[model samples]
Target chain A: AQTVTQSQPEMSVQEAETVTLSCTYDTSESDYYLFWYKQPPSRQMILVIRQEAYKQQNATENRFSVNFQKAAKSFSLKISDSQLGDAAMYFCAYRNSRTFGNKLVFGAGTILRVKS
Target chain B: NAGVTQTPKFRVLKTGQSMTLLCAQDMNHEYMYWYRQDPGMGLRLIHYSVGEGTTAKGEVPDGYNVSRLKKQNFLLGLESAAPSQTSVYFCASEGTGQETQYFGPGTRLLVL
Candidate 1:
C-alpha cells in the first residue's frame, strides 16, 4: 500500500511571497505518479500539479512547481508569489502508473493561509 | 457540461434506513469512483467501475454497494446506515485509467 504524508497541518504565507508545502510518500513500486490537490471552502478538489517518477526534471505549472526527489521519496509543492486565492487545504496524492487506477492515496492535508 | 454531479447535495438517514446516492458524469469517462472523506483521514475509495455494467470494490467497500448501469451514471447504496458511515461522499471520473480525475462537489450525509 502507498501512503502520502503532509507533516504540516497548517501553513501561512504573506501575500506576494513564496511558500513551499512539504509532501513525502512511501511506495514500493518503482514507477508511479505524485499529485497535489487543493480544496477551498467550497470543498471542491482541484488538481494543482503532478509529477511523474521517471522524469528527472521537476514539473512547473505557472506559479505552482514541485521539487520531486524520487530517491528520497519526496515531492514538495512550491507556490510562488502566493495570493489570497491560494488559501485552502492542500493534499498530496500517490498513484500507480501501470494500473491506471483512479484511486488516489491522499495525505491528511495542510491548511494554507494567505495573509494580506 | 456538468462534468460530475452527485444528487441530493445533503442527506439524513436513520440507523436502519437504506438510501442511494447518485453520481452522474457527462465527460464520457470510462472509469468512475466513489470515495468517503472523513476528518483528518483524507479520502478512501469505496468502489469503482471501469465501464458500464462493471463494478469493483475499492479500499473500503464493506458497507456500500455501487452500480454503474449507464456510462454516465454511478449509484452508491447503503443497505443499512450507521453513524460511522456518515461523511462527505465524493464522486470522480477519469478516462481510461491514469488520467487526472474530475470530482463532484460531494454529498454530505448524516446518520443518527
Candidate 2:
C-alpha cells in the first residue's frame, strides 16, 4: 500500500511571492506517478502538476512546479508568483504505473492562503 | 462538453435511509471511481469500476455499494445511512490511456 503525507496542515504566502508545499510518500513500487491537486473554495479538484518517478528532471507547469526526489521519496510542489487564486487546499497523490486501474492515494492536504 | 457531472449536488438523509448518487461522464472513459472527502481526510476511495459491469472495492467500501451497468454511468448507493457517512462525495473518471483522473463537482451528503 502507498501512503502520501503532507506534513503542513496550513501555509500562507504573500501575493507575488513563492511558496513550497512539502509532500512525502511510501511506496515499494519502482515506477509510479506523483500529482498535486488543488481544491479552491468552489470545492472542485483541479490538477496542479504531475511528476513521473522515472524522470529525474522535475515537472514544471507555468507557475506550478514539483521537486521530485525519488531516492528520498519526496515530491514537493512549488508555486511561484503566487496569486489570490492559488489559495486553496492542496493534496498530494500517488499512483502505480504498473496497474491498469489508476487509483490515486492522496495525502491529508495543506491549506494555502495567499495574502494580498 | 460537461466532463463529469454528479446528480443531486446536495443530499440529506436520515439513519437507515437509502439513496443513490449518480455519476455520468461524457469523455468516453473506461474507468470510474467514487470517493468520500472528510474534513481532515483528503479523499478515500469507496468504490471503482474498471469497465462496464465490472466493479471493485476500494479502500473504504464499507456501508456502500456501487454499480456500473452502463459505461458512462456509475451509481453509488447507501443502503443504511449513518452519521459517520456524512461527507462530501466526489466522482472521477479516467481514460484507458490517461493517468490523470477528471473529477466532478461533488455531492455534499449529510446523514443525520
Specify the highest-DockQ model's number: 2
Q: How close is candidate 2 to the true structure, as a TM-score?
A: 0.99
Error of 1 at A110 (Å): 0.5
A61-113 per-residue lDDT for model 1 (tens digits): 99999999998999999999999999999999998887755589999999999
Per-residue CA lDDT of model 1 for B61-107, tens digit only, reads 99899999999999999999999999999999998754688899999
RMSD of each: 1.0, 0.6
Error of 1 at A99 (Å): 1.4
> Per-residue lDDT of B65-96 in model 2, one digit per residue for the tens?
99999999999999999999999999999999
Across A21-110, the per-residue lDDT of candidate 2 in tens digits comes to 999999999999999999999999999988989999999999999999999999999999999999999999999988777689999999
* Superposition error at A52 for model 1 (Å): 1.3
- Badly placed stretches (over 4 Å) of model 1 are none
TM-score of chain B of 2: 0.99
